[model samples]
Target chain A: MNRLFHLPLSPFSRKIRIVLGEKKVSGVDLVEERPWERRMDFLLLSPAGQVPVLQLNGTTLSDSTAIFEYLEETIPEPRLLPRDPAQRAEARRLAAWFDIKFQREVTENLLQERVNKKLMKSGYPDGARIRAGSANIKYHLDYMGWLLERRHWLAGEALTIADISAAAHLSCLDYINDVDWGRNAAVKDWYARIKSRPSFRPLLNDTVPGFTVPSHYANLDF
Target chain B: MNRLFHLPLSPFSRKIRIVLGEKKVSGVDLVEERPWERRMDFLLLSPAGQVPVLQLNGTTLSDSTAIFEYLEETIPEPRLLPRDPAQRAEARRLAAWFDIKFQREVTENLLQERVNKKLMKSGYPDGARIRAGSANIKYHLDYMGWLLERRHWLAGEALTIADISAAAHLSCLDYINDVDWGRNAAVKDWYARIKSRPSFRPLLNDTVPGFTVPSHYANLDF
Candidate 1:
């Protein structure tokens, strides 16, 4: 059986969870890890002290992308990355967009304002950062809207790693009602499609202490 | 022929340049891009307003990882990323270390103090940022030293994308004399091997106006 160390609100961790669910790796044990607590075992698992560390057999893997590739090769069923090289590159590009761009601008900001305060119970929220996040999210939502407007999925017709990466971050933000779904109908519909996936059900059910899910959070149709 | 809009100092851009060189992709037109200028063509190529943006065939590829993957797939011979799934994951992990961890602590600070100041040509260097950069770099250098002491390369015996990623960032930092080579002998030796590579010579030859490379910049053994 595999062991996975993760945090509920972490997009990277959620990415791995979704991938595990998608791949149907049922014999794995999922444990919530608080990296900030600086547990010795966690440090031994990953020197960088980040979550989403997976232990398979005797080897441990860090980094969500690395884990994804490992899973793709080890399992190779229900492919997450495209078989065509160009298409695979496209999937990776979109995944990087959400992980780096949207994570930084949208998810990080919302977490700092909504989740971090509740979790850490310290540091007052800055209006400027929150405002910046709101403004930037609109831009990103519009970009996603444009992409979803054209294709059935974020990367293409098939559901790829990109969709999982995006939904991970958006799901976290959605928990605190930071996302304005009304900004774009296409983007909203796209999120709904991704949200209803069997892999996403666990993510949708996640509830953080001192935080409550929005009215639309558990609603599949919303 | 492909077109690359790049800033010579950018590690991400240099990573692609090395990939192009390694793949023997000839007739590549290199256009020096100032991202701050925010040209419409560049924006069209990359909405993130970063370089290197590769206008290859008809598709535009942005983000170094994406561009590198595109090249690797298009040119299957002399691969940069390993063919084995686990090895590929290891390579990506090391690459991510350079891209995310080292970039945040070292490259970002050095760029702000050294290149960003010159590019912006604004106020004097921020003392705190420079101090933070110097202190943080030593720790990273020490960690790299420890890693290199065990393996022939950063990730393993084979020089993978990890080596290229680390060298790309270090080479840029070296241009501004930000790296303290005397800090760690093992790390220095590892860098020397990377410096001696044929693809890296062009990067060393780069000279920005109002900024001068150290005398050892061109010396391969230095």
Candidate 2:
């Protein structure tokens, strides 16, 4: 059986989970592990000590984007990237925008500060980082809103990994009630569309021990 | 008629430059731009306002990894990634190790603090960050040495984008004379091999106005 080592709130792990669901790939056993535990066994599988490690075909794969690309190459169906090279690059560009830029600006500040700090007993969330995250997320939402206004999806007409990547990061932020859904109508509508997908169900259902999910978290209408 | 907007010491820009050279994709006009300048025109091209933006085939591509993948897909010869899906995943994983992990832990701490602050006239380099970066790089170099002891290159036998990515970051640090080359022999040997490549020439020749390159930076025998 294929197994995926993940954390409930890790956006990278969530991105891979959605990709698996979208591709209709089955037989993945989700194993939740606290990366801060630094288990020697887990370290052997992922040198960077990150989650979203997939064990398949007698090999372990770490890095969410790498795993997503591997799945796209091997499966080739329900394509997450466009056929045109330019379009594919655009998709990847947007994906990186969320995975790297948005992650550094917002997710790390909000989620890692608010949630991971508690989980690891690291300390209280830094007030400045929280304020920065709150301020920065509005800009990102506006950017998403602008993109959605121009195109049917983040990159173009198709729902690609770009959408998955964005939604993954946003969903985690939403879980912590950090996102202001009312700030951008277009972004909210876009999230609503992606939220209704079956791939997003498992994420909505996820519940961490110390944190309570927002009332609207699992609502499709939300 | 291809053009690339880049910064002299930016690791991402350097990686793309090396990729273009390795692939022998010619006719690129290099335009040096200060990303922090946030020139409205440049921001229109890359919303993230980052460097190494490529203009090719009437399309503007941002994000170094996205650009590299696009180049690899469009120009197949002298492949920077392995043919096998699993091998490709491994290559990408290591590439991210440098691009994402190392960038956050070391490059941002060291280069962003030391070089970018000076270039942008932002402020003084924080002493704490410099010390942290100095400490962190030792672990990274040790990790690189461990990997080199097991493989011919950073990823495997044939040098891939993984090597390019690692070299790009290390080269920048070396340019600042921040790298302690004598700390790891295997890593030194690996850097020597890559530094000798024709693709690495342009990077060695790169000179920022205020900073002086270490004497051994351009020398293969270093």
Candidate 3:
């Protein structure tokens, strides 16, 4: 069977799981591994020692975006990116926004500090970083709200990887109860729609040992 | 005429510039812009207030990877990505290695600390960060050396975006004379080959007002 090496709360790993789920691609087994464990075998799969490594068709694939693009090319069903090149670019741009920008500004600050630090037995979370992440999330939510006001989805008429990427990051934060859902009605409604998807269901069930799954995290209405 | 809003030292910007140059796609004008200026018009082009935004065919493109993908699709010659999906994934994975991992570990520590701080009038460069970045780059160079020892290019036999991405970040560091060419023979030879290319010439010629270009920066024989 094909296998995936992933961490439960890693936004990148979650992004791939959602993609795989949404595309309805099957026969893959999930292998949860904390990257900090520095398993030599896992390191061989991904030099960066990051999660979301996929073993498909006897080939090993690493990097969330690279894996997503590969899947899209080979599968092409329930298409995640738009047909037009410009629209595809827009979807990718937004995907990068969440993966890079939002990850740097919000997820790294909040989730890494609060969750991964503890899991890795790293030093305590910095209070300043947590505060900065809290502040940064508001701006992101407002930006998302503004975008939703103008379109049915983050990229356009259809839901794309852009939405998946943003939700992936937000879901990790949401698991930690870091997100302020009350800030934007549009974003909340959007999240609710995404939350109801079967692909998202498995993610909500994920539980890290020390961290409690928040009450609203698994709720469809949340 | 088409236009690109870019910063001379930004690796992401340089990546797009080299892609455009190698593809020999004409009619795009370069508009150097400091993203910190927070120009409303520029922000309108990229809400994240980042550089290397491209204006072409009445469409505005942000994110260097997005722009490169668009260029590859619209102008197919001299492909920066491999035709095979698996090879393409490997190329993209390494590209991300430089863009995200190397940038965060090395570039943000060295270039952003030393150059951007001075240009932005931010406080003095953090000594700890500079030290961390300096120590981190050795491992990266070693990793690149290992890869180059096996493959003709960073990704594989073809000179793909993986090489462009790694060279882009290194070129910025090179501008500050931060790269230790003596550390890795394979990486040095690979860089020398890439440096002699027509696409890399303009980057070597770049000059920032407050910093002097290193003598070896533009030397093809170096």
> By descending DockQ, how would the candidates be arranged?
2, 3, 1
Please write out the lDDT profile of model 1 over residues A1-222, one tens digit for every residue.
689999899999999999998999887888999887889988888877888999888778998888887998899889988887767878888898988888788777778776776676677887888888888999998888888989998888888999999889888888888889899999889888878888889888878877778899979888
Worst 10 residues of 1 chain B by lDDT: B114-123
Candidate 1 regions off by >4 Å? none
- Of candidates 3 and 1, the better by DockQ: 3
lDDT of 2 by residue, A50-125 (tens): 9999997687999999999999999889999999999999999999999999999999999989999999999999
Could you tell me the lDDT of residue B194 within candidate 2? 91
- Tens-digit lDDT string for candidate 1 (B35-149): 8888997897787888988888877788888888888878977888877776788888889888888888888888777787778767778888878888898988898898899
Candidate 3: fraction of native contacts reproduced: 0.76
* Better by DockQ, candidate 3 or 2: 2
For candidate 3, write residues B1-222 as lDDT tens digits: 599999999999999999999999778899999999899989998998998999997999999988988998888998999999999999999999999999999999999999999999989999999999999999999999999999999999999999999999999999999999999989999999999999999888889999997889999877
Q: Is candidate 1 or candidate 2 better by TM-score?
A: 2
TM-score of each: 0.96, 0.98, 0.98
Each model's DockQ?
A: 0.67, 0.89, 0.85
lDDT of 1 at B46: 86
Residue B100 CA displacement from its true place in model 3, Å: 0.1
TM-score (0 to 1) of chain B for each candidate: 0.96, 0.98, 0.98
